[model samples]
Target: MSAAEAEAAAGSEYPAHYKVMLEKLNEQRQLDQFTDITLIVDGHQFRAHKAVLAACSQFFYKFFQDFTQEPLVEIEGVSNTAFSQLMDFTYTATLAVAGEDEAFDVWKAAEYLQMQEAIKALNKKIDEFSSLAARSTSKKRKIAETSNVITETLPTVEGEHVEIQVMGEGAIEVEESGAGGSRRRCKKCSGIVRRLRFSSSR
Candidate 1:
């Protein structure tokens, strides 16, 4: 077998092992089994094991290792849902944030707790958002450029009369005294040749 195949086979062999371990740990946490610490956040109490938390979070590791033996620890500035999701992630290896706003909130909570994995997940989201924003900007720029070219290149002639019609948002239909004209269509602009038409699909 090739090295890549060997690696894939090896990975497949071990995938379920860690997943099962995480699920059992999550079950124990749900049952409050061998819980050593009680975390209070926004008037809500969460019972968890310090070892698991310390392993998952740098803040928890340092607090448990260097600080006092306080059984009840109060965390501030983090929302209930965010913290709940963080803890659920810490034990179950899953981050189930509802939407973008909640994902950002979880990111804040993860940053405060200094959790590398959750922070990395949030980083992926940020990268995805940046990519989407860049694509949108590029599309808008293309549309604007196309519109500018039509307005500037086409000069006012005596025979051809230009009529403007606003069909939809960012959509304009320019009618010239001509027929058999080729029509070009895109999300941002359409019928760009001869008789310029704007499409609102984009």
Candidate 2:
């Protein structure tokens, strides 16, 4: 792929929301060094560094708490619980949201939190959508290409000849004349007409 195309593809693979989260985390990092920050969810408090906290929003923390059903541990610096919560939130958001924008946002939040599972899941979902769109586009292109009319005339023995006209998506019409008389075929496999030709009148 060209550089532009590769960049575009990479952008598509990383959901928009995920990208935002990464930006936010980077911004937070620049503002302050990584320091423990407390997060409150469901009457419970969890501790993580400023970097991690900035990467994860309240929505993700709550989602993770609900999923774990247990009080998360507070590590000295960055907490594993925080990471787990981020991943759970991302997966949940992607599954719950109807809009691609929302899904992307949640994916980004997860990515900012440095949740591997969430990033992988988001990538997979994006890939699936991309594949579906490509297939649809391919089908449309094929339909357009096959809809044109193609006509061909072939010479035969004893002043007889055949004129073939193909129409529709894949329909073929053949008019043949010889000592045996004229014959016509429509989209049928004709072993006799081995060497078929096509041309555009327009």
Candidate 3:
């Protein structure tokens, strides 16, 4: 696979928690049903949950903490586009910022809002989507440069058969283990493989 494709695939493997958060964010956006506060930016209105905005942005956090009643807020000196992306990032923890200009715009808004999480996420996405050839060291090389490590096991028992799978850096082995287990070894002893078995009594 191409370096860009590999990098994208690696980056897309976000933790399960992030997946859940993203799903909830998208669901909220789709409903657009529980917004308790409105933000007025560049003469446009945006409905959002105060808790979400306060959680993701220190600026909003302090503002909300001090004000007992603020149903509407007016932001100054931020473009509608940048604010939109910032809102999206605050809810989903993902940024769609593309070119340097777009990145800079959203970054400025994030900085103004004191949203550190959004800033870090934007930087990571920017790096991940950059041209693979533009960097001095290839991502593939970086990933491959890690010390030889093999740590994975998949065992399954179905009916009268036992199947085991061992995965390593550059190799994988699938073996069948019945009542009597099976042993597999590499010629160079590059990895450790364990046998799995199922009793015949069942």
- The backbone clash count of each candidate, in order, is 2, 4, 0
Global lDDT scores for all candidate models: 0.64, 0.42, 0.61
Which candidate order results from sorting by TM-score in descending order? Answer: 1, 3, 2
Q: Compared to the true structure, candidate 3 yields what TM-score?
A: 0.53
Clashes of 2: 4
| lDDT digits (tens) for residues 115-146 of candidate 1 | 99988886666556556656777778797775
Best of the candidates, TM-score: 1
Q: Which residue runs does candidate 1 get wrong by more than 4 Å?
A: 1-13, 129-202
Task: Give the per-residue lDDT of model 3 (tens digit) for 1-202.
Answer: 9999988878765499877976786677646767767565654556788888888898778767865364555565577789989988777766777665677667767766778898777666555545433343455556778544332221222234323333333322223224776444322223333222222325
Model 3: lDDT of residue 55: 88
Name the 10 consecutive residues with the lowest summed lDDT in model 3.
149-158
- The clash number for model 3 is 0
**Runs in model 3 with CA error above 4 Å?**
1-18, 125-202
lDDT of 1 at 67: 47
Choose 1 or 3, whichever is better by lDDT. 1
Q: Where is the poorest 10-residue window by lDDT in model 2?
A: 191-200
